[model samples]
Target: MAPSKKMTFSRRSFLKSSALASGGMIIGFNLFNACKPEAKLPVDLSALNYNDFNAFIKISEEGKVTIFSPNPEIGQGVKTSMPMIIAEELDVLWEDVYVVQAPLDTKNYTRQVAGGSQSIRFGWEPLRQTGATAKQMLVNAAAARWGVDASECSAKNGVITNVKGDKLGYGDVVLEAAGLEVPEDVTLKDPKDFTIIGQGKGNVDIDKIITGKPLYGLDYKEEGMLYATVLRPPAFGQILESFDDSEARALPGVVDVITIGEKVRAYNDSGKNSWTMPMSGTDKVVVIGKTTWDAMKGKKAIKAVWKTETALESSETHDKVLLDLLEGNKFNTRRQDGNVKHAFANADKVLERVYESPFLPHNCMEPMNFFANVSPEKVRLVGPVQTPEAAAQVVADLLERDLEDVSIDMTRMGGGFGRRLYGDFVYEAAEISNAIQKPIKLVSSREDDMTMGVYRPSSKYKISASIKNGKITGYHLKEASINGNMYGLIPNFFPAGAIENYQVDTANYKSNITTGAWRAPYTNFLASAEQSFFDELAEELGIDRVQMHMNLLDNVKNNPDANIEYSPERLQGVLQLATENSNWGKTEAGVFQGLSVYYCHNTHVAEVADITMEDGVPSVKRVTCAVDCGIVVNPFGAMNQIKGGVLDGIGHAMYADFGFVDGVPKSNNFDSYQMIRMGQTPQVDVYFIESDIDPTGLGEPTLPPIGAAVANAIYAATGNRINKQPLINNLEPKEKVLG
Candidate 1:
């Protein structure tokens, strides 16, 4: 792995430093700070200030420091973790530091996104440099004031001390630091010196979250803001023909009724459409009312007509298409090595199996809501969105305003899981506000949120392996999905370089139903299928499952492919850790265990599932996971992420199911959609490998392997292979559906 770049800072000639109203210092730096105009500092030194950069630190006269976190916090703990990185280098007391969320600033910040678990991975070095530069400036100021060489002064815990034992608090030199030139270079502390980065810290928003304070988008309110409930088409292929709002208008607190979708289409037609634009079908009825309840009631009162514009898709039809495509010769080759046809034909034995997964909704607890106010002068938006920069741009395009004129304030999200990555709800709110020329908060009911989601694409994987002389000689993987195939990254992962004659082919059937990133994206299900297949392969070869994995890893390590994306050493470490901690081959009688290891989202994780008989059915009792994501920024937060990911993976694989019938979702609410309850949740124990490598992602990596581990455990206990999800359908044969 490449070491993190050593960042440098220098004084910009065009910009002038200014003092705060209370005469404190505010230091800010960005990679492109020299090219951009100076950011205007806020007058109040105590209040959180928005400056241009990844992040900035503020010093008050009372020796208190505030760090503004730039990225969105979608319950991933970046709001707390990112600021911790800054404070660690700033040499400040963790208790005296306060963290605040920064607003959207495209000109000042880059990669201000919260997807793919890249927040900390990308923020690691820049945030460290930000704090280190500020600390160096303070030290320089103190040295200059004391009439001593800067090299003789050292800073610790917000205080500067000289060689002679003279000391000064950061606050005492704040004004001097503000006027001094920024140091060109500062050395970062070694990993051994870190105190706050590795320590456990409570979430910055935990208090407010538990106390029911206003933080999420649903809790936001504005003066004279109207509540909106949109009535969309009931099915995927359907379009809104017309709606009569006579009864809706008569309802008390109903302000008005309007239609949107034409403007969105017009924007797309204008040739400015991009991937960031909303893929959710257009055409909907917006009911404006005084309260969310009134708007929802008004929506129910409206009578709407819908007409199908395309073929009404059904799950049975999708299943048939996917299976047929797998058998057909037409396919797009994703990866190819030696000839697989020749190897399979000459092999002594061949094993084949198909794994299937259905579409899944994100099921975010807060639903979808955004506050938008469109005036002739500017557009103001406040909500929980993962991609605020994209949301602002799309609204700007729809309203034909300058991007600079649109401002977005990101609120803490109840849950994102990749649903908020799209800006469909944001543009809808902007459209509604612009139509009425008033501020509006668009709220989606649980049903609406589930039915209108950009779901995880339903997919099937046909994996076949050829064996010769009791050794695996070839491997082939065929994938078929709705709208898309597995991302390009997965084809280059493990088992790719391990096999000599490897081949991967993919085919997709495009559908009107919106499908996009969901949590770990395709890896969420792919890992489960791939891991389960590996276990079966091990059994077919008459080798211990753990030993087989070690051998394959050894192959990759000895001779690696140029396209490989994972580290064999790291993966081997986690697998060993997890297996040892879980007592892989030494479980007590009546207890069956399965292991799975995977690398994704730049992190390596290994999971072991323990299962036992309950009421004559296999039950997951506990899950033990080992992770190697370089460094653990916050142990408590990292553990929470691992536990959550493991549970989410097991829940979806075991019970969560979604299907479409005649273009309509079969499960639109909790009553129909199954989720793992607290009682059914397994005990998850997580252990992290200690390393000096820079930190990687943790939010999504732990999810991929857990499903496979649980499925393999079930197979071990019941002697029934689960090739389909939800695993419940196969475990209970009566509930199974045939293509």
Candidate 2:
């Protein structure tokens, strides 16, 4: 036994501007190689050891391997999986490995935030290396003590033993090994020999989540943090005429009332067809207070008026404005696949339909909030953010300080769904803090979160399919008018060369309403239109729904056209598994089930919806899903995401998720903007594909297809095609929607 010299080093993390903020890394596609999944080792725990990290793995003279993870634990369970990588290499019992979040630094940790579903995938290699390398170093230390060659010394279940059976617990060897420099290029476990990794593990933070621990941004509170609420414009394209904040400033707990104005260059095009971020609007009162409730109440008392220049917030204005834009009289052309005029010119059976989607609020359970303390010398920004690096950069620029002067501490996100990714809120917090010269937490009331947010832009799709005999040919999707293309990650991630005589065009019109990313971005809308249309086409061909989807996926997988990229194995498995699980061709009593499959976030998911009608209204009873996200770290967490996403899809697909008048969002609260209740939560069955294909994303992929599946089921139940969303509830068809 020897004395431990020292055991500590600062953690390393890479900080970069987010694509959601400035096109550094696109949301849907990989601008960074770090977002892709790495191949995983099989589950087998044979040869293992632990070395320099052995000190960190101290046993108190008892025994434990402290697996320090460089990634954050938001909801997805990397805090558990990262330790499993080390446990496999250390030959330690699962219960003995205590996982801890790594501290922040640039050189030590990998990409720390969770996004693009790359957590488990990117962590597979580096974490495994971290474990395996430590094991080898420990084995060397153990062999030296036993007077034996390293090869003759084997590690198993936290104990290193020589051929002669001389044993040393990991705790005993830590002190001697900490002095030796760790060797680079230490052998990593072979795919066949891996034990703990690639196996299903429970979430590391389950206790925290279940016992109502402070694991989310909403729970964060620090000394000297004040609360605040702002008055944003009621409608988009409106300007602040004037304000009377005399009453607001006099309110209890109200420290000051401040007014802000929208400044230019607050947002950049992140490059998805004029899809831009927001500039913190200065059209209202700001109530600074000792508590959130006080600040929010004070904001309501402020008297203000904003001039509605574009269109008054009215339902008729909404209808008239959207109808004129759908006539293809807009500026932004999101995507143009082929000569739509030429194709429509030669078409025989041109099936044309128009589908409308209302504006969507992100509706994260936790409201939007940010905390900032700004001064002339330094700036500190803290919040639950999807893009900490992006927020830091924005703060530095806005404060006119060096990038290093700004420090951002990212807290656990209650949910991103895409709303927390914006830097405007971060910018606003900084500005308010700078103006007041104090530490303040900018909080949004549920109503403010709805109104002030850059929502999922309202859109309408006009699709035309050219079907000829039993075998079909040409297809074209002409997206009518929308504010911003959600496919900011790629110009077109979908509707690519799978169809020969096809065209996918998008047109965006200017509106006072602001827009940003929602879950699955444009994919949810694409799936609703494309998959439902496919069902309609299949009905015309008199083909089985399962077989029809299989044929399409088969053609795409067999020859991906080399342009569009996705794992064929994953796509086929989702299709096959979902088909098998749902008993696709079987018929239920008064129920009809519809199916849809899609690929995104580097993962493939297929969903089948069981629909039933009661009292003339259709309801989703159950949804069975098959997902192949490469490797799932925490089975429970992944299932939670699948279940949550499925219900989220069902809620939006069946109800009016967004209520907008002119450019203003009408649904500001739960009463107006409905959410899926407990009664609506159907039985969800999620199946994971058996593979070691690295980790793909889980947060978003499950979302795109559920809406389409529900729509397809409605098609099966009624002779009417539900290509348009909200099911076009007027079943009697008293007066038809004139095209």
Candidate 3:
């Protein structure tokens, strides 16, 4: 077979071409290239090797196989699990395979994003095919050398074998296979034959992480790099009026005090009707110094004045604005099923409840920081970012450099629920470096990162249902939120298609405080509110809580509505598993249980939380989770994700909330804004349904259900129906409440 035609590399493709050229035996994807699959290829190898392989799999003559992971590692274990899938299909031993994080290259790798729990869900097939292609090429090469039919040869454990028992190692035949043309298509290994995927494996960076080695963004260092810090406006809609930096400049080790102007965001009419990157950082003063401590002291010494813009929106007015809109006559209907008006009027019993959640901050453990070296000819950036492709584009535009002249390297993140998705920190570092004409590292203090936040918008929901003849006949939900509605109240969620009459209406109030995607996005709030309401309905009907959910699942199964997105059998699988594992409806004295199930990002999860009162506060004693994400790629990593998500959900529901006064955030540090401590963490047990289906996302699907489970358990423990978040103060001692 002859090699495929060579092609030139685009600016994006050239980033990874050099790495692929040195690493042998890359996969070819002419089939998916024309159709343009959502997950893209490796950097184009054609420019370096003159052969158009996708460039994901590589083998060296030293008996080593190197696989490139194409997603950002934000503590979700993609840095380990993705390579496990590829190595499984390639028939390589786990010990000999090494994983590498691919750089930002859009031409070869499509949709290099870390949010929505979509890394493995979208890359399963493409990565499997990449490995199988490499295996077939090696088998063919071995057969040709042995002068036998290709069907008589077999590959296993990185070795090629013939019918007569002759064997050749993958490293010995890798060079010969590299000369052959990549096969257009190849059969993937059956699930029963998988040796590396289903088995438990530790994170690739465990040794480095546990041994106090440098692997995160804050640990990154460059030659002749100065530390920089910026003082942003006190609040949103405020601008820099004046500053006295004489004291700051006079401090020892202080280099310069520069003023960064407010950025103007222009609407991009030439393309989609969306907002692009701003011109620069917020209106603030930048303090450049020799060390991080020096920058911190200098920043504190500087004095500045700010003036608020009266015309802009304020958080202080959002609550009243949202409350007014919820009752107003005008609303945009997102989904409507049967006649809700007629069913509500004719129902025997009507149930209505209101739920409110406050805006929350990401509070990533490492704070926000990035290192950049910008020159007139080229720009280089290294940082912890969720979307590297978007960051590269923003850096090029901000520095007035060509796309080909910019390069980005991804680092391990301390934590990024969804905070790193934006390129704000990366752009800030690059701009400061460009202005100073030197390499620099920008670090944000805990207070700085907390105040200048793009938060999870506050939201309110009014959910009502009409029950007639012991069956839910009508369902209506009205949501009002700040910024924009994250979830559009689709009909695919629970009780939407299950009921005969369903309708959803929504309204949005403008906000000056920046807002963006949070973990699990809108499902985090919607699932909690809807599930808690369902528990109330079940209590009113005198039915088992688990049985109530099971009945609704049966409804969706029997009706077969086109609006249903999840399979009824999959939902039932997790629910039944959770019920059996937690021994639902049979709890010991002093222990109350809550059950909830949800499906999102192509994954279904059911969680049961056991709660008890400890010193007048709700204490989560234990939690059991049942997840059905098709197939478990890495059992250890998947379990870790579920545990982490459940813990995060519990913390946010029980203790985390942020408030605003006038236009400034009231909670700026951990003293005011609380986080989950190790003492509060509950014991978690995870179980997975055995299946042969393709893998789905596990990072976020387990999060949404945990909140409802905890909230429902709290209601069971106490007679109060808590509709608002931060349930800390809401729960009082039973003795005090009775008095």
Candidate 4:
């Protein structure tokens, strides 16, 4: 591939710089500083023996290939799969490639985040180019040695050979390859030639994971590091009024207790230039001790009084306000495609429904935790962070140190989902360590993590559609939620551009309860609202649900809108594949089925649920999914993501929800907040669409449609239209009425 103009940092300059930095041994490139000119490495690059190659492919003298994965590995399997992409293009043996997690260096790496399913989508091409560029250098080296044209030579399995029979192993010419000038252009192997991309390669850390090796942040330990737990506000709207830590301090293992303070800002408070980083949460008291258990005990021993503001908001009030907004006709129009008023007036029948989704907590297997060692000279942190670059910035800003002085080492996350994307936990650890002048490990108990952590915002959707002669005439979606609003509701989201008379309106209710991006974010609830409406429309039109969606796709395909976002063909592809794979419409007598399709994160996914309730509770016996993410990078890994996404979505829709009463989270642990158990998890069968298009994001696309699929399946079984979420608690299954 002739280095696309998109690649400003050419491979030639990269290899030359690598050779100059390490005397022609290391093959690495630093795009961090190239992207951010302000953030430069403090070390003298000219004097160092080896420059840091943020994401590099190094060929050791023994022919072993090492590829550094720059993104954080939060169980999305990027740590292993990203390296496979590079190795596939490098034409090396999969067994010979070793993957290493790169450290947090903004000067050496850019976009070291794990959320938004962007890791694979972002790394696909650039990583392949890195490998292709390296392979070309090896081919050139071998060609020179044999005195043959480079075009006449080919490299495979780390061996280079010319048509004349001159051959050389990559190891035999390592020095020569490193010495050779990097080629300006290189060719990437076609997908048909790929040996690793679509293959089922086990995770590189599978051994460490299964053998209970120290990989997660909770497993991290350091000398002189004290364990800490924060006694945050009893509720979101409360703050630490006072605390008496005398009894706790006298405990045997209790080290010290420090208070975490916060400065609250209004929703419109963005004009100020003095703010470095927004406060993570309300102020709190943190107890430090020799061990985690000791810290837990000390926290219990401590007496603290929280200022539970009587006027503080609660979920009850937020829901009431949102319900009022949904009931009212006033709205802030986000987008309007045509004359919805005229279309509704001319319609044959009108149908309207209000759907509500509760706030959700990301119950990662391992609770929030981080280890930090802060001193005047330097600050170091190692933990499970999805956004390492953002975490480093928070540390550097908190310590008043340069970005280069802040070192962040990302550890394998027990689970992130979307909770680890925020650096609030990292900030807490750094602040505690800095204040105590000693290394510290900050941990949040399951209760604290569930109650105090950032949460998925609860949303209310008031959707109305007008039907004319078995076809949708007009559509209007009015969404109300807490915190900041969203923008992609109109032209970007599906069914919006497809419908001619479409209007999307939004409203926000400000609150002290902090909300952040959960997996799939707005799409999670939006899909539930929109897809359920489509099912309802299908029922109104006396047609099959899948066929109704197909008819709309046909309308979108034939009468295309000005700014259509999703591909009708891809959506149709997955829908048809899902039905075919799930044996849709042909199932056991007792089993009820529901189908839903969605497109998000550049991927299209259609899910079908085969459900049969047991004792008034739904049991998902099996889930069949059709995924189109351009190309499957790793078959098993991609399948696992879909499986996990399906299970996660089902778990949340069935029972996982958070409630706030008097500003304190009611569901603080598994007892109140339920997770989908293994016995309840369905057997997942996944199929991917074969295509030549580049790989897209798969981490979250499959999750959006699952809630609706399961809900619709429950409706099919019970004839109960459940408009609210957490169907286990919300849906009233009086009697089984299977159709």
Off by over 4 Å in 4: 1-9, 12-24, 30-53, 262-282, 485-491, 733-739
* lDDT tens readout by residue for model 3, 263-352: 223113323221324222346799999999999999999999988764455455777788887888678888899899999999999999
Number of clashing residue pairs, candidate 3: 3
- The TM-score values for the models, in the order shown, are 0.96, 0.83, 0.93, 0.94
> What is the lDDT for 688 in model 2?
85
Model 4: per-residue Cα lDDT over 366-395, one tens digit each: 999999998888898999988887777656
Off by over 4 Å in 3: 1-55, 262-282, 311-316, 732-739
**Whole-model Cα lDDT of every candidate shown, in order:** 0.86, 0.65, 0.79, 0.80
Work out candidate 4's RMSD over C-alphas.
3.3
What residue pairs are clashing in model 3? Answer: 27-54, 40-110, 41-108
Candidate 1, residue 665: Cα displacement in angstroms equals 0.4
Which ten contiguous residues of candidate 2 have the minimum total lDDT?
Answer: 22-31
lDDT of 1 at 71: 88
How much is the lDDT of residue 337 in candidate 1? 86
User: Residue 380 error for model 1, in Å?
Assistant: 0.4
Residue pairs with backbone atoms closer than 3 Å in model 1 (clashes): none
Off by over 4 Å in 2: 1-74, 86-91, 100-111, 190-195, 198-200, 261-277, 280-284, 308-348, 375-377, 488-497, 557-562, 567-569, 728-739
State which candidate, 3 or 4, has the greater TM-score.
Answer: 4
